[model samples]
Target: MCGADRLVKVAFSGLAPLVIEDVVVEGDLIRVRARTPEVAAACPTCGNVSSRVHGFGLRTVADLPVDERRVVVVVRVRRLVCPTRGCRQTFREQVPDVLERYQRRTGRLARVVGSVVRELAGRPGVRVLSALTICLSFNTALRCLLRLPLPPLVVPRVLGVDDFALRRRHRYATVLIDAMTRRRVDVIPSRSADAVEAWLRAHAGVEVVCRDGSGAYAEAVRRALPGAVQVADRWHIWHNLAKAAGKDVAAHSACWAKHGPPLNDGPLARTTRERWHQVHRLLDQGVGLLECARRLNLGLNTVKRYARVAEPERLVRAPKYRPTLVDPYRDHLRRRRAENPATPIPHLFEEIKTLGYSGSFNLLARYITQGRVEADRLAISPRAVARLLLTKPETLTDTQRTRFDELSTACPEMIDLTNMIRGFADLLHPRPENADRLTEWITSAREADLPHLHAFTRGLDFDRAAITAALTLPHHNGGTEGVNTKTKRIMRQMHGRAGFPLLRHRILLD
Candidate 1:
């Protein structure tokens, strides 16, 4: 070693280097007592080198252990004076063991601390660097990462780009996820064309851009990387289709809701239904039914065809009118109900029939029974309601129609208790002006710029008049919403700590 350098090495080594240094060990660590003066050099800017040192600072810096023990050497550092005229240059000089100009810790020690910061702790390497006696913010930690000598980014074959808004609806960022690897490649600040373009240009070999339908991305890809094939993603297509269908169904919900009763099930009901409708047509046509029925080839025996059957009682049976029963059980039912407030229906049926009531046991009981019973608590068979649902107006006589209207009014709350939200959707469609609050409704839809959603909307936007014809239609986003909900649940299970790596993989892969 050179004379000056050798003296310095020996001073720091306790016995010096290039020769044996007597080493001592401490438990779990080593202590090397070095007395070397800090090295000095000229500031090339000033061309001044001085033996007269500026001032020395002491630090007990960690180093590689002499043997197995950790070696921390207490060292003193120095600065040189610039002797050049017109130069404002007294600067701390660089040294072999120490990092950059005027650094306190050696290069090796700083690196060890930085490594510990990265692997052992998630602390930003630069901020942790302060622990090594250097002061820089966590941003400086980024420099350490950058300093690792990054290789050129290898373009993946297929890249997926999607935007996620982090804070509710306000702040958005782009995630450049890898479709093949199913991992996040990087994140960009915005969905802007420039930002996406910059990313594409930086990674040269990208083959396919898989994206949800978005015009912004399309424009960006065209301008930035024209050669890359852009494939429309599935998620957006389905999402938009669902949205359009939902609106269509919502507006026409009532049409679907009221399909149960067709006004024409049995032959009797069908005839009545057609005749009644024909009567309305006559009224609408400004022609009386007698002439119309002649045109329709109907018999005048039909009550509606008879001009003198004006009073409803002439054509229809009076409701609550009892049958002329030859039933044997009638007298017994009369006795039991008169004596008791509650008579079980089955017992009544049995008692009346055994007494040789001629009318059907069910008919006698149904005719005799009287109470304010909840529809659900009704003792009669449910098949009747199902039958009624399929029944047509023609199957029911004028008397039956009167009875039906009375029963319908008896359960007036059914109309109000029906699916109201569904009703609201219908109201948005073809509902009457008075029934709908059209004055207040803003009919325009607020749509997102997503391409899939846009394409889906195009179908609805095309034939809006047809969709609006009925107030009740059946479109549903239940499945899509359900999928998103399930995704959140999986995320929480993965531990509120999953990175984009896990999230991206789970979604695209699945």
Candidate 2:
């Protein structure tokens, strides 16, 4: 070891321990040329430092990641001998950089391997890490995954609750994500009322909640967050609407299928006999069209048209062409729904097709959802009914307004539903009456429900007041949903291999 003023005494410190003598760095590789500090190690039998280099070799080792640089170090090492003349096998090879025998990298490098693997949860993120650094072994990476931080704690103002299963068609778990922050608030093991209630009650600060139409979530919200406003989410509202339309379509589907083909009046009239039964009976009895229309619930014009059709159109209805296609087997869907209502659609479709249903799934789904519209219509809240009634601007025409105003003044309860519609309108344009009317309507609903309204006073049993407050504020949890989507993307990218801690760091930092 020489220096400018004099040769600086940079002798190695260990008696026989391997020491670094010189170092070089090229890309991610660090080359360290070193040897045993002393010529030999002291023998247990002779207790003397033997002046011998038993053997010497060079080994390459990986190092911890440093900034944009990935690193590996090459170390030159030597084995030392014991001084005893007849000592059996008195020497051993040395290790460098806190590594075990046969280990290709330093301990810190192993930790880094573990850190990425645990953070990402598996190989997906590991592959990304591989592209950035060295191609690490799966086992090595897996060892450090799952060192994830516990998910963050959020005091939820409102929670948008939903569920998804890793594997479809069997198990279900309710997941609660904060409607304001969009962080996953909590996850319950099942859809059970008790589990949902327990979790909801344990956490406070949920003043409002948005949920699907499930009575399960409604009951849980009532039991746990007695003061929380329970409002139906927009997605559920639209879903309910689609379901309603499907039911109407399905109910009359047979009529459509039977009459869809152009037909001669003979067998066509017989097959669609139900469609013109009133006109036929009237004609058979020589009754007039006006009387027949009322009796058969058909339009007078329809009866007249049927009466005048050509004789060829007079026979029983039959397929215009041969019945080449087979009708769908409806029994299997009935069996499936009976056996397990929760089975996913794709699975159910497969099961029914196996049982001889040749119909397209859309048609089958239409049949399955045949009566859904009626059900959805029946389930429409007074609030929704009001919205629909007021949706058209023509409804607010001067003549219409006079009628509506009279209706409102005469039936205040009905007017309250209308007020909600108007409150929603206020969201489109700023108006003072909007807020005043919203508050007034809410107060009215509360006052009307008072005698049986202990909980109502607490602002949980009824939602009008909460809806009014929300209207006044004019804000929503849309941002939260966006954040949730991003969170999912982050999880997908990481592959959930990394433990929660590192995952959190990456998510927050990245």
Candidate 3:
């Protein structure tokens, strides 16, 4: 090959089929002159090969970077005339590998744009491309990504499915994953049974499905793949159990008030207590929170805080010493507490309000809280009890264990509840042999007199088959959750601006 031919071959080595004829470099831009290998151009309209050149045309196309500089391909294309009679047509000769008919960018450059969009997405992808001296706009890059074909679907043997919030507590979408390969299969727009059933029906060969506690997905799987084994996620089960336990502990709120330490005479307690009284006084006088706030010259939020609580004692803060105007009334408050330690703070606040007490309700609340602390040294918080019930005993410190033991003795109902929760936890672990024990635990929970647990057991009974399979089989929705986390990351990176098509492309293709 001669010098010019050598230069042409070297310039267009990777961009096959379109051999380069000349190379020109100016500033940061490199222009390569090229032509198609074929001498006869085919008429796109008539599909007739024509060697008779009707004319010559110049087409500028963007290409991949050449030697750290942006490359622009200037192709000297030939427009040809159709030879067959009555098939009047003249079309440009085409190099399909290098450029499409109307595309401004070469096939290689388009692929580069696609890869960048896949990695960085929209605006970020444009920024990255611009930084590399390859000019691109956010819209162009997004369009390139949107035009990408979908990934080939597979018939996964083990499928994992779950729902993730698109806008949280509002719009939600479902993600399906191949559990065995840990690759996302597809993402559906809705978390409904129809959406999931449609996806399951499109693909076959799913032997087992691991999913969260969504009844919709369970129903979808049951409807679409009756032969496939459905396994409930163990994490969701424990999560539900914890929520139920917390509710059960909260239901015994009176136990906390009765046995809790005295409301401390702290600044927070005094402030809240005063606000509580002010709110109640305004409400009793048929005044709304906004009007009361204006009348008291306080923030609407402060007045609303006061209005939210039913009793002044609920405003009492944790045990802490604080100097307040009610210090002079401490002696009176102590005497009242001694006479009736269990007396509610609202009653005491009222009694003190009649004795020339000009202090706020919070001042009396702090004093009352302190008195309760001194009087009730053995008071246990229901929240603390709830934490103990949820935590494994082996993980507790000595002090925590001692406190837990005291709570169990003080509230025998807690002992029965903990035993039942433990039994349910046991059924969730690697104990396929104990699958039948779940039914027994459900029965005990229904009769345990705890409304929360009864509700939880009812849910377990409704999905008993899936729950049993979860305990028996090794499959779980772990992969589905991981995929959802990845999806969340993508959503955050895109600032949640991505529409469904772009979002799906980023997830499945990338």
Candidate 4:
């Protein structure tokens, strides 16, 4: 092959069906002249063969870059006449693989744009496409994506549904997913039950719906897919229990004050105690939490916590420098133990209680059992006790365990709550005998007279069917949660151009 022919073969080799006739190179632009390789054409309208051409024209089209330079394919297209009777109109021949009619870019170029839009939404996609030297406006890129046909819909047997905030607490949208495949099925505009019901009505065959504890979704499922099994999400159930337990801890604020260390005179401790006292004093005078917070220059939550408790001691924590209850009596206890190595703990406690040992016998027992007392033991608060009960036992440290055991013995209420939390956690990871354990836990909580746990158990009883299915069956809303995360990312990446259709397209297509 000659030098020019070799250049044509090298540059346009990948682009077949359009024979390269001429090649030109300008600064930052590569222009190629090409024509159809076919000698005869079939008339599209009449389905008859035609060799006689009415005219020939040059059509310029953009294509994929060659050697990092922009490529423009100029093709010589022919307009052929239809020979069949009554079909006299002339029609242009089309190179199906190379170009599509009315599209300025090649079919390959459209495919590239489509892929880019699928990966990155409008503005980001435009920037990426521009860097590749195939320039297009943001609007054009989005329009190209919108024109692409949607994937074929397969009705899902197991559907997962969840709601994501469109504008966070203001506007929200619902995302539905195929639970087994973990692929997004559709996105509705709002989280209303009617919207979800309409979607369920449209696509039948949904045997199972895995969703969070949203009343709207529950109602929608009951109305639309009445026969489908609903499985309450494990994460949401745990979350609700946690929130209720937190409220329970907050309600018994007086207990915290009576049990925690006395207020200190240090700057931080003094300020905290003073704020607590001031907020309580104001609230005693019938001041609201918001007004109290504004007056004290503190957060509303802080003010609420302070006002909830009967005294400022509840707000006070053990000071870092201040000696613990064990600290003051440590030397005495040690001296007595050294004097009598075989002394009984009851005799030791009797000796301390007479000498102003206001600390619990449980605390003294732990100190004797551990053989040493650390300063961190003084820092344990009722909130800390609640946290320990809420957390898993395996993750607790030696100090936390000692403190927890002491606190549980001191407060029988805490022991009951701790058992409830642990039993609920066990139910979360259910086994064959979980049903018996659950019934026992429920009966115990009701009889314990703990309002928080009783209310939580009552709520669980209300949703017992769905909650049981969630624990026993292998289905959960984890897939729906994952889809919600993906949907959020798509919306955030879209930036200012977050229209519902574009968000839906990116989610479902990806």
- Tens digit per residue, CA lDDT, model 1, 1-510: 499566546434523311223334568665655434444466758666766666766545555434344556655545556777677556655545542554444566557655643332223444445444444455444334334332234567777676754344785556665566544466566888889999888877787676655667767888987886665543343344445433332222222322221211346545655665665566567876677668767775452433322222122211222234623444455567778848787777676567665566556555554331211122221223223322454687786565444333333222221222223343443344612342222122222212222334454344332233222222222232333454454344341232443343333323
lDDT of 2 at 68: 49
Best by TM-score: 4
Candidate 1 residues lying further than 4 Å off, grouped into runs, are 1-60, 63-71, 75-151, 165-171, 182-187, 201-203, 255-510
Cα lDDT tens digits, model 2, 1-510, are 346213211321221244566655566654455553554445545566665776766777665544446555556665666656677555554444444467776665666665665446456646867777666766556544533344566767877766544224775556576676556665555777788888877777777776655678878988888877875554333333334323222222222223133223555445456656556767789788888888877788667656644232232332222221123444455556668877777787787677766767776455445432122111222233233445555756685555445434433334443444454444433344555664554465455411212222233225444344444443344543454455566556643433444444444332
Question: Model 2: residues >4 Å from true position, as ranges?
Answer: 1-62, 65-120, 139-143, 242-510
lDDT of each: 0.47, 0.52, 0.77, 0.77
- Candidate 3 is scored at a TM of 0.68
lDDT of 4 by residue, 308-387 (tens): 55555444443223344666677677788788878898888888888898888888886666445322234344455578
Sorted on TM-score, best first, the list reads 4, 3, 2, 1
Ordered by lDDT, highest first, the candidates read 3, 4, 2, 1
Q: Please provide, for model 3 over 247-343, each residue's C-alpha lDDT reduced to its tens digit, 9 standing for 90 to 100.
A: 6665544444345555346576577567778778879999987899899999997776566445665455333344566756666776877788788
Q: What's the C-alpha lDDT at position 448 in model 1?
A: 22
TM-score of each: 0.34, 0.41, 0.68, 0.74
lDDT of 1 at 189: 62
**Regions more than 4 Å wrong, model 3:** 1-13, 16-18, 36-57, 66-68, 77-97, 100-102, 168-170, 252-260, 263-384, 393-410, 446-449, 493-498
**Ten residues in sequence with the least summed lDDT for candidate 3:** 313-322
